[model samples]
Every structure is written in C-alpha cells, then in structure tokens.
Target chain A: MKFMNNVYQVITVAKKEYIDALKNRVFIIFVSFLLILTFVSIIVSSFDFQAKVISYQTALAELQASHQIIQNLTAPEFYPLQLLRGTIEYIEIIGAILAIVLGYLSIAKEKGNNTLQLLFTRPISKIKLFFGKFLGNVLLLTSVSGFMFFGIYLIISLIGKTVITNIEIEKIFLSFIFSIIYLSTFFSISALLALIFKSLSNSLILSFVIWIVFVLVIPQIGDTLDPDNQVPGGLFNKIGITQKSDQLTILKDFSSYEKARDSLEQSSFTKHYERLIFALLGIKDMYNGKTINFIINDKNSDILWLVSAMILSSTLTSIIFTKKKLINK
Target chain B: MNKIFYIAKEEIKILFREKIFFTLLGVFVVMSLISSFLGFMATNTTTSIYNSSVKFLIQKGINNIPPNPMLSFGALTDFRNIIIYMFLIGALLAVVIGHRSFIRERKSGVLPILFSRPISSNTLFFGKALGIGITIFSIILSAFLIGILSSLLLPYRHLLFDDILRLIIFYIFSFFYLLFFGFVGLLFAIKTKSESLALFIPICIWVGISFVLPEIISGQNPTALLNPIAMGQVQVQNSVFFSLMQTYLQPFSIGGQYTSFALQLINNTSQTSLINVILNNLSNITTLFISIIGTSTLCIYSINKNNIGKDEIYE
Candidate 1:
C-alpha cells in the first residue's frame, strides 16, 4: 500500500515536472538538436559507408595490381549497416549530456523557481517526489529518442535504403541500452546534487564534474594502466637484453621497428586495450588458435564489476537523497 | 567590491556546507588515487617489459626511431589529448555557476531582499559574477593541484614535470573557458525568469557552440575536422572581424597559421593549404578578444534589464 502510494505520488510530481520541462525552451531545443543529430548521423554514417566502400575498392586495386588473389570479396552481410554502430555511439554521448542537463534541472529547477517549498507542502513522500522527477525526465527523453528513431527509420525505409540491417538495428538497441545506463548515472548525480547543493547552478556544476571524471578521466586512467603499449627500455635494460631468433621482423628489424613504432604511435588506446585484453582473455584464440595462447581467466569480469559499481552508486545516491530533508530555498 | 566579496564568501561557505561538493571532491580524490596507483603499476611494469622488447628489437636491426615516454603504460598521446579536451568540459561547471546566480536568488526570494538594500544593479550583478568566479576558481585550482600532485607523487615517476605543467596550463585555460561560458550563462540566467530556462540555456549553448557548430564547420562529416579536440581550444577562428576586434582589446600580437592536418577530413582538402596560409598570417589575439567582449557585453545587457521581484522589493 505504501509503495503504491509512493508510486502514485511520484507519478503526480513527475506529471507536473514533465509539463514544465516540455514548456521549457531549453528542453525543446535539446530535443530539436537530438532530432537534427539523428538526421546528421544518417549523413555522417553515409560518409563512413562511402569510405569503407572506397577502402575496399582501393584494397582490391592494390591486390589486383600486385597479382595477388582478391578472394572472398563479397560485402559481408552486415557490411552496409556497420556505420550505424558509430551513429549509436554518437547518440549515446548526446544522451549522456541530455540526461545530466535534464536530471540536474528537474530537481534544481524546483529550488531555482522557488517551487520546492510548495512541492514539499503537497502530502507526498520525499521518495515519491524525488523518483517521480527522475522518471518523468526519463519518459520525456524516451519519447524524444523514440521520435527520432521512428523518423530516421521512416526516412530510410521510404528511401528504399539497403543500409538498414538487423545487425544495425541490434547495434542501435545496444547503444540505447548503454545510454540508459549512462543516463541513470547522470540522473542519480543530479538528484544527489539537488539534495546536497541548495543552488541549482552549483548542483549543476557538481553534476558536470561527475560527468567529466566518469566519461573522460576514468577511461583514460583505465587505459593508461594496461601494459602492452609501453615504450621500450631506459637504455640500461637494453644493455643485457638479447634478440631472439623467432621474433617477427616488424618487432626485430631496424626498418620494420620504425614502421612498428609508427603504427603503434598512430593507434588509439581503445585499439591497444582491445588487443591486449583480447590476448589476455585468450579471445585471440578465436582469431588465431596456435602459437599465441592467453592463459588468463574471467576476462569480462572487470566490465561486470564496472557495471555493478555504477548501478550500486546510482541506487545509493537515490537512497541517500530520498531520505534527506527538502529545504525550501 | 564589498558586495562581491560578501557574495563570494557566501558561495564558498555554501560549497563547504553542502554534501554534494564534498561527495564530488571525495569521488574525484578517490578516483585519482586509484588511477595513480594503476598508472604507476601499469607504467612501471610495461616500461620494464617494453624496455626489454625494444632492446631486443633494436639489437636485431631497429633504427632511426625516437623513444616516446608517453607509451610507458599505453600510447597516452591520444589519451593525453583527450584529457586536454576534457579541460573544456569545465565549461559545464561555468554554465552551472552562471545559470544559478540570479536564477537561484530569485527562486529563494533573495533577489528582492538584496535589491531592497542600497546596492546598485551593477554591483548586484558584479557581486554574483564575482561570487561564482571565485567559487569556480577555487574548486578548479584545488582539483589542478591535486591532479598535479598525484601525478608527481605517484610511484612510477613516469609523468614529467612538463606534463604536469601542461595539465596546469590546461586547467588555467579551462578556467578562462569556464569564465567565458559563465558570463554567457549569466546572461541567459538574467534574460529568462524561468528556472528551466537558466539551467537549460547554457547546456544547449554548450552543445551548439562547442559541439554542433564545430560539427557544421567540419562539413557534417566526422573525418574533416583536424584535431576534434580543438573544439575545446579557446582560440577563435581568424576571421577579419574577429582580428580587428582582438587588435583593439589585447596588446599581444596573436595569430599564426592554424592549419592542423587533423581537421583535413572536415574541410575541403584542396583549400587546406590556402586556409593554413591565411590562418598563419592572421592575428589570433584579435579574434579571441572580440569573442570574449561579445560574451561579456551580452552579460551586461542581461543584468541591466533584469527586474525580478522589483515591485515586491521596493514596496
């Protein structure tokens, strides 16, 4: 009975917040941007689509010129839609910012508008009030995201485009899932901020700071912790180190070493981490079974841990903020 | 000045009183600590291992290569570049500060109370601005000091002092960018009496100016922009109008060829050479000054027109 009451109260609060948000020009602009971005992504992904085709053509030409066999050159079943994966990622980033802004504003706006005091006067529980606001914003985002998706899908379908594949749809769904997780974190941060900081702006700053650390800093720090992409010795270690006979030319030969170094230099950390993680997890066997064996167990465990931690934090933040007193600013 | 000081002091006091700031600070420090430990272990282990690998490679035949210490743990060059890009992320904080100032006061009934006093509108505006500026600066400075100290004190000793300097410079640049955004945010805060308007306007501007504008300038393609991170760069383009404005504002002769190959994919490749030449020849200081002035002027206008709770306060 209590839970239902809480839910109803939250729903009521959320309805009011949602209406307020819809009338807000900023939210409208954000939704507009998302719509535009969805279309823009269609355009951007098309470029990638073109680039990949060109790259394949160039590869074919090079192989043919060199008298090498260009075998199995058929476009993979998922070929056309692969760029959609990138589009989804771009969307997730946009979604992250949106979640932070909306969530932060939803709570902070009450105080800034001098409406929080009035809100507290309503016979609703704080939990309902807090969760209601977050869910309301989430519903709004879902609507906007759904609209964008529908619009894009319609345009593509109408155009009789061959690029929309089930695989691409799957990737888009995966991206949407990830966006939910990302958005939840931002939402929790917003609630936490709204409770902790009396001023809407300061709360926003805190939310923004949280986003920076999670999205930018931690990822970098994670990569910078891995071992495979390290620089060579400090000259002292080079003194006694001997070259092994079976080493690849790229690793051993002087000219090849420069090329290797250049290749390594140009590569992104994500790529480096992927390679190392794959090898460590023994997933390299999936690509090549012999000669290289990765012995480590539970490779995906860290990802699980990260996901769990994020969920835990979000839950804890909600619990903490829900019980806190509503200050009438 | 007194009003400014009082407001700033109040801002700082509230920051300390609030759990959010402490929570965030704790989060940052803990994250930094963990990262430092991981960086140390990863860099130390990889450097030792890679040192041997490099020796083996070189002893067999490797030549004409420069050793990049940046790869001690990972090829951190891109990661480092992203970290630099993240500095611009502080713009969000500035936006929040600016958006909240008058917007919050009005929400809390503080605006009318303050106006009831003998303070001039300019002083009121300045006080709020100064309060936000000081608060932002203090938080940023603390974060910078912590980040640099952690990097230097980390066990691996892999990070160079210069790297720390780069981080500091980036922090300072971040602060300036924050101020730039802060002023703009303040303008928006003052323009709209609505609470949602204050919160959302700055974010939308950030998304538009910092994200979408660059996207448009890059010709709707991902590859066209030379360093995507340059969007965060405080430097404005060397447009003639911008240059003229900058020349009138700052004493420094700024501007140089700004053609970065990273942006090639974003621009028409053929004109890149010419663009490079033009950018090199133009004075950058002029453009930067103009943009700052434009933002500041907008803030001034917003503050001047802001008349929230006026009748209530005067009566």
Candidate 2:
C-alpha cells in the first residue's frame, strides 16, 4: 500500500510539472524553434540531394549523347539517412539549451514562489518529491525527442521517397534514446545548479556560462589546437595528405598538444554525446552507411562516456536536491 | 550634457558592481588572449613545417621551392579568430551589458526616478549608450593590449608597424560591430515585456545572424560556413537563391562583412586606404550604418514613448 502511494504521489507531482512546463512561453518558443529547425534541416538536405541528382543526371545524359563509354557512369547513390546530419547538429545546439531552460524552470519557479516550503509540508518525503520532478521532466523530454524522431521519419519516408527499413527505424529509435540521455545530463546539471543557488537569475546565468563553456568553448579549443580543424575538409586533406595514417603520423609530431586537446575534449560531455550520435546516425562521412554493430563496436568508448556522464550528473542532482535545504529564507 | 554624463557615470558604476559583469569581462579578455595565442601557435607550426620541407627539397637538389605561404602578409590572418570570437561571445557580452543598462533598471523600479530628474528621454538614452560605449571600449582596449603582448610571444615572427596599424583598424571595426549588437539588445530590452524573453530574443538573433543565414548562404560548402577566408576559395555555379543570398544577405551579415574587411586589411592584399575598401563594399558599409542608426533610433523612440514608471507597458 505504501509503495503504491509513493508511486501515486510521484505521478501526481510529475503531471503538475509537465503541465507547468507546457504553460511556459519560453519552453514553448524553444520547442517551436527545435521543430522548425529540424524541419528546415530536412528541407535543406533534400534540396542539396536534388541539386546533386540533377547534376548527375545531366552528366549521364551528355555522356549518352556523346557516345561515351557508360561503364564509368554510375548513378548517384541516394543515402536518405544523410539528412539526419543537420537534425543532429540542430539537436546538439537547440536541444541542449531547451533542456537547460526546462531544468531551470522546474525548480527555480518553485523556489521563487516559495512553494517548495508548501511541498515540504506534504506527506511525501523530499526524495520522492525530487524524483517526481525528475520523472516529470524525463517524460517531457522523451515526448519532445519522440515528436522530433517521428517528424524526421515522416520527412524521410514521405519527402525523401526512401524505403524505411527496420534497421533504419531502429537506428532512429536508438538515436532518440541517446538524445534523451544526452539532454538529461544537461537538465540534471541545470536543476542541480538551480537548487544550489538562492537567486534564480544567478542560477540561470551560471547555467548558461557552464553551457557555453561545455557546448561551444571546449570543442572550439580542441579544434583550434589541431591545425587540421582550422580549415574545412581537414587542412591536411586540402594539402594531399589523404590517408588517415598519414594524418595521424603528422599529428603524432605534436603529441603534447594532442594530449591537451584530447583531455579538453574528454572533459566535455557534449563532445562525447556528439561523437556517439554522429557515429550512430552516420552524420560523419566516414560513418555513413555503417551498420549498427560496426558503430557500437567502433564507438564503444563514446557510448560508455555518454552513459557515464548521464548517470553521474543525474545522481549528483538527486543527492543534492534530497540533502539540501528546501527553503532559502 | 552634464546631466547625461552624470547618468552615464552612474550606469558605469552600477555595471562594475555586478559580479556577473566582471565574470563576463574576464571571460572575454581570457578568450581573446587564448584565441590570439592559438592563432599564433597555428601560424608558427605551419611556418616551421614549411621551412623544414623547403630545406629537405633543397637537399634533394630541387632548388625552386615555392615561397612559403605563412611568411607572407597572410600571417595576419591568424587574428581572424579574434574577430570570430567578437561575433560570438562579444555579442553575448553586449547583450548582458544592454540588459543590465535598461531592463534591470526598469525591473527594479529605478527608471521612473531617473526619468523624473528633468532629463529628456533622448539625453538619457544617449547617456546609457555612452556608458555602454565606454565600458565596451575599455574591454576592447584591454583585449588589444593583451593581443599585442601575446603576439610578441610567437617566436617565428616579428610585428610590423603595418600589422599593428591593421590590428588597430580591425579593433575599431570590432568596436562598432559590438556596439551595434549592444544597441540591438537595448532595443529588445525596451520592446519586450518579459526580461528573460528580452535577453533570449537577442540570443535568437545572434544564432540566426551568426549561424543559420551563413549556413544557408554557404550550402554544401563546409568551409564557408565558419571561416570567411574559405568563402574566397568556394567555386559554385550560382543558382537564383545563391545569387540572391550573395547580393542581399551578404551585405546585411555584419559579422561576415567585418570579418572580410578585417581579413583584407590584415592580409594587406588591397594595399588601399580603409576608405577605399569601404567604398568598394559600399553596400555592406551602408547596411552596417543603417543597422546601427536604425537600432539606436528605435531604442530611443521606444524609451521616449513608453511610460517609464509602468511595468506592464511593454510588448
């Protein structure tokens, strides 16, 4: 009976939190932006594919007219999965910010309104209350990610005119699962910060600073450290250093710098999440058309890092909220 | 005029008292130094590699080693990252400054008192603008000084007077570019009802200007997305949309324009006066000027029309 009651209380709180999140204008705006951006990315990728197809068809037509050998004129392979590349980038940037905002609003609103005291006066324990809020947000994030995945699926199947195989659907599902985990880590961090700081604005500002550092600054630092990352298509590739081993050989000359860059990149959960998703969704050119088994096997460490980050951040948030004082005044 | 100065002085004082302000300022300074330093390191590495390759080629009896690209005026391209940083973090800092200058005052109910002091809204607006101008100027000046000091650490190259002059010119352009963003923030702060939304609107604008438009303009050309230097190397058969982006969108992209102008100045490719460069890119210059003036006018107009005492009077 007690266990059932606890579950019921958690559900009740979760529902309240979900309703509150829906009413938030900022959250609404962010969700709209995410959806719009995702849609736009799909459209843009389709246009890009169309342009390539037209050029390929034109070349093929000219070759046939000129009586050239048609053996070398292979048709362009349509990798509809490549459209997810832009979606992933948009998710990386916008999804993370949305998580932060949702996390902030979840606790900061209660604290600002002194409703935490009222909640503490309830029969439920603080641990349960915290879990309820977390559960609520998890459901909300899942819904958001699910909506995005469905949108992507519709665009790919309807617009790209591609057959959605079971394997492709599985990959999309797995990517959404990973996105939820990746975004939950940020949500946990933001919630923890909100709980720690008395002032809502301070917490929000600190969260943004941390977000900027992790999301923008760290990856940029790593890119800057490697001369190859400064240029598009890899600087070495531009200069005829096409082989991966040759690139590594050149990079080995700057081992100390590489070590620093690697360390900085490892410190950011954003990098780990990006690495895993890029591999899983075939966002990177090298990863395109790779099987799920190949991605999992090759990117095992990235998967480990992402899961670890999500666990660590969520655990920290739970502990902090349960132990910390509820009232500021 | 004296009243405006007093208001400006008070605004500056309030800005310095906030911990967030100092933290942001520190971030800007440190990031500027680090970006400039990394740029120097990247150039030095390239130069060393070039020298060693040339030596090996000469030893192999191939005497006609091509001139090292890193040793030319293009070495100044290293500082392009600083301009990029100005567009990203520098714009956010401006938003913060602009928010604190106007939005915070309105939120704290201090604006009515200030308005009651017999000062016209135009004078007050100018004062706030002047205060923000001074604060941003100081930040940029420090960045310039630190940039110069850090550049001296690059072992392979010596600073030329021409390089220094170009750097100064770039910093001047950066100041105006950042000021325009600040005014944009102020415009939103005055226009929006919610304070958080006010701040968020500016960030949305930043992302749109800095990322989205450029991505659309540089479709399929990955290099042109981030680095303006790579835009020069892109060879595309222009479609109608592409042509439209180049002609219309390119002029309004203040960040791209500033970056391109800075790159030209630092590379010394034109060897012409800054005025000539401005004339050459008249459309871009006009767009930038119009943006600055339009935003300032809107900000002043918003402040003048709105009742400063009412909290519910914003959009």
Candidate 3:
C-alpha cells in the first residue's frame, strides 16, 4: 500500500526528468552529432573494406588475362561488427559527457530554481526522488543505446550488403545493457557532485575533471605503460613469439609488469565496459569465432566490475541524498 | 595600455583564487613531474623485455639478434605522453579559465560598473584575453621547468642542449595551442545565453577539434588512438576518402597539427632535420594564427554586443 504510493511518487518524478531532457536543445544537438559521426565512421570503414576486395578482384582478372597463376591470391577478411569501433568509442567518451550533463542539469536546475525546497515539502522521500532520477536517466540512456545499435545494424546491412547473425544480435543487446550501466555510473557520480557542491559551475567542472581521469587519463596511462605497445606492430610479434606456447613462455618473465597494468586498468569502469563491449562485438580477433557464452565466461570479471560499479554508485548517490543535509546545501 | 595591464593582472588573480582552477593546476603539475619518468619507464621495460628475449634466443642456439632500438631513440621523444596530457587536461583547464573570465563578472553583476569607467569594451576584452594568454604561458613555463628538472634528475637518461632546445620549441607551440582553446571558451562564454551551455559548447568544440577531426582524417576509430596495437590505421590509410580528407581537412586539423608538430621535433619520429620539421608544420603555425585571430575577433565583436542590462543568465 504505502510502498505502491512511494513507487508512484518516484515514477512521477522520473517522468518529469525524462520529458525535460528530451526537450533540451543541448542533448538533442549532441545526440545528432554522435549519430552523424557514427554514420561517417562506419561508411568509411565499409567502403575501405570494399575497395580492398575490388582491388583484389581487379588483380585476379589481370592475372587471368596475362596467363599468370592466381593460386596464392587471397581476399581481405574482416568481421562486420568491427566497424562499430567508432560507435563504441563515441559512447565511451561523448556518451559519458552527455550523461554528466544530464546529471548536472538534473540537480542544478532544482537548486537553481529553488525547487529543492518545494520538492522536499512534497510527499516524496529524498531516496525515492534520487532513485526516480536514476531510473529516468537509465531509461533515456537505454533508448539511446538501442537507437544507436539499430542504426549501426542498418548501416552495416544497407551499406556493406551483409547479414547480421542471431548471435551478433545477442552480442549487441548485451553490449547495449552494459553500455547503460557504464553511462549510469557516470550519471550518478555527477549527480552526487552537483548535490554536494554549493556552486553548480564548480561542481560541473569537477565532474568533467573526474570524467577526464576515468575515461582518458587512467586508461591511456595503462595503455602507454604496456610493454607490448613499445613497438609498431607489437613486441610479441616483433620478437618472434607468435606461437602461443612461446608467448606464454616469454610472459612468465613479465608477470609483475602485466599485473600492474591489469590492476591499473581494472580501476577504471570505462576500461571494463570497453573490454566487455569489444569482446561482445568481436572487435578482438581471439574472440571472433568464439561463442557468446564463451566470451561472457572469459570476460566475467569486467562484467562484474561494470555492474558492481553502477550499483555501488547509484546506492551511494541515494545514501548521500538521504543522509546528508545536501538538499538545501 | 596601463589600464589593460592592470585589468589583466586582476583577471589572473581572480583565476588563481578559484578552487576548481587550483585543483586542475595540481593535476597538471603532478603529470608534468611524472611525464618524463613514465617515458623512461616505458623504454626501460621494453628494453629489459627485449634483452630477455635475446637471451632466450641465444640459449636456444639462434644465430643472430637485433639490437635495442629504443636506445637509439632521442631523449626528448620519451616525452610523447606529456604532449597528449597537455592536449587533454591542459585544453580543458584553459577553457574553464576562459569561461570564468566573463561568466564570473556576469554572475557578480560587474559588467555595467566596468562599462561606466573610462575603459572601452575593447580594452576590457583585450585585458581579459591578455590575462588568459599570460596564465597559459605561466602554466606551460612551470611544466617546462619541471621537464628540465625531470631530465636532470634522471640518471639513466640525459638531455643535450639540442634536446632542451626542442623541448623549448614544443612548449612554445603548446602555449599557443592551449590558448586557442582558451579563446574558444572566451568566445562561447561571451556569446552564450546559458551558464551551463557556455561551458558545454566549448567542450563539444574541443572534442571535435581534438578527437573527431583526426578520426575523420585518418578514417580510424577513436579506439585505435587509445591502444594502437589492437586496431591500427592500415586499411583506411589507402582509401580515396582518406586522401581527400588529408588534402582538405588535415591541414586545418587543430589538434592534429599540434600533435604532428610536437612529434616531428620532440619525438623525432619523422627523422628529419629541424628546419624540415618546421616546414612540415607550416600548416600548424598558419592555422593556429588564424584560429587565434578569428576567435579573438569574434570575442571582441561579441563583447561589444553583450547586453549590458543582462546581469544573470539561465542555467
């Protein structure tokens, strides 16, 4: 009875947030920008792949006309989902910023307009209101991810003239859910910061600083510090350790460095989200032909980290909004 | 000019007093302290691994081995990560500084009072712009001194006079590069009607400049920029669209120009003479000048057009 009333109050608040964001000009312009970038990046990649095959065919025909052997020729190979690389990165960087903007605006507007006091006088608890905002944003990000994935599928099919497999669809769906969780973590963090700070602009700038650290700086440090990235192709490939046995033999000597790099990457939810999504999309070669379950099993730790971070952040935001005297702060 | 100097000095003081600005300055200082060390650490780890591989090969009775290639690389080249750090964090910090320059005045209701003085809008605008320029220069100088200290303090590596000259040149260009973003922040701050939008628009523009344009030119995804070994720029580097993008947009790619400019001289990745490196970055110098002049022109024009009666704006 009372629980249902509380749920109703949360839903009402969430509905208002959704409508507010939907009407925002900044959000609209940014979503359009990301979609356009996705379209351009994927088309370029598709045509680049097609050009390779066309050139191969042209060479094969010339060889036949000149009475030359074509026995050793081979066509370029690639997975279709690999073209989603740009889309993934767009979501990681721009999408995260959009979430921050949403979160900042969420609390900033209430405080700016002095609606926080009015809302507090209402029949809703602060925790329910916080959860309501979280749910509203989670729904919005999910819709964006769904729209983006659908756009990617249409682009690949219409442009590349290929069919997406059922397994591929499942991978996209799983990636979609994790993408929401990743975005929601950022959303909650920014919301908490906006609630904590007295000045909205400073809090907004601080949220951006946190975004830069988690999204760009930490992951980049981990990548640059990687010993394998020292060479052009890779250290392992350059030094004749292509064989799995030999590679394992060599890696035994660098376990400490590798562990340090892994632990550093583990600290960033962006990296975990990236790892999980890239595996699901078959962007990494080792997982290209692997089953969805196998990829899920292999990337279980990243999956857990992303989910846990999202839940923890949301819980923390709720607790702070409830326990602290932050509403009027 | 004296009034301009006075106003510029005040603007700098106001920026230094901001807590958020101080926080980012601390991050920039810490990164600068570790920039050269991280570069050296990467080289050390790579060389150590290569040596181990060589020993393994020799034990297996292999005939020949390759020498350590990283040893031949220049000392300044190890500072590549620092260049990227400036591009990311330094640019954002500059934007915040610029946004605050005008927005702070507007929030505090000082535009009318300032206009009532003998100072013209041009004087005030130039004063603020000069203030931003000096602030960026001071930050870069601190990083420069830190670079020198790191180079001197490290034992395994040494920087020659030429290496120091290259660092100086790179930091000089970096100052202009960061100032352009500051100008962007100023332009939008002066023009935009909303407070959050003022900060928001400049960041979007920064993303387009630093990430999207280069991605379009290279036809490589942003992921490749992060971890290169996973997916490289091999396939699209040969496309017609890639060629066209290079000829047209690559010259004006603000971030790309800065990156290649630094990489050519400091990283020595191009293996060219210093004069050749400068000639290669001719586009960088021209476009950076154009960006600075154009943005300042708009900022100056916008300042004159500012609504004097408007004290505060929508969020």
On DockQ, the leading prediction is 3
Which residue segments of model 3 deviate by more than 4 Å?
A51-74, A239-241, A326-329, B226-236, B308-311
lDDT of 3 by residue, A30-88 (tens): 77877787788787677666667778888899999999999988878878998787888
> Which of the two candidates, 1 or 3, achieves a greater lDDT against the reference?
3
Evaluated on chain B only, candidate 3 has a TM-score of 0.95
Instruction: Provide the lowest-lDDT 10-residue window in model 1 chain A.
Output: A287-296
What DockQ would you assign to candidate 1? Answer: 0.17
Model 1 residue B256 lDDT?
Answer: 14
> When superposed on Cα atoms, how far off is each prediction in RMSD?
10.1, 3.4, 2.4
TM-score against native, each model: 0.62, 0.90, 0.95
* Model 2 lDDT tens row, B1-44: 99889888998999999888888888888888887677777666
Per-residue C-alpha lDDT of model 3 across residues B172-205, encoded as one tens digit per residue? 9999999999999988888987889999999999
Q: Give one digit per residue, the lDDT tens place, for model 1 in B133-242.
A: 78778767776666656655655454454445445544554555567677877777677755555656666666555444444333232212213223223243223433
TM-score (chain B) for model 1? Answer: 0.64
Question: Candidates 1 and 2: which is better by DockQ?
Answer: 2
Best by TM-score: 3
lDDT of 3 at A62: 97
True contacts kept of each: 0.24, 0.07, 0.50
| DockQ of each model vs. true complex | 0.17, 0.31, 0.55
Task: Give the C-alpha interface root-mean-square deviation per candidate.
Answer: 9.5, 4.1, 2.6
